[model samples]
Target: MISQTLTLELKQVLGALLFGSRRPISVADMRRVLLEVAEQNGDVGGRFAQTSA
Candidate 1:
């Protein structure tokens, strides 16, 4: 499991990456991207939840 601190960092990073994105990003897009990254390191949900907040 990833620490909350690290999760927050990734959330910030991913948010920044997505902020410059063009067009609308749907829920599936967010889920897929977060799951792909999270399942790899076991922290996707943490980052994803942060984004939702």
Candidate 2:
């Protein structure tokens, strides 16, 4: 699970990105963004698809 601190940070960034878009953020887009953030934060070790660590 993403720490509370990390989740807040990601939400802030995601909010900014979403607000900048012409349309609402889609589920796929959000998932892609979150997965990217998870990789950067080294929080993907728990998921089989993200076992790159």
> Largest TM-score belongs to which candidate?
2
Error of 1 at 25 (Å): 0.4
lDDT of 1 by residue, 1-53 (tens): 87565443565646855896787777667766665665565654545543442
lDDT of 2 by residue, 1-53 (tens): 87564333644656877888898887677667667666666644223224231
lDDT of each: 0.59, 0.58
Clashing pairs in 2: none
Q: Which candidate is the best by lDDT?
A: 1
Model 1: CA > 4 A from native = 1-10, 42-53
Q: State the weakest 10-residue window (summed lDDT) of model 2.
A: 44-53
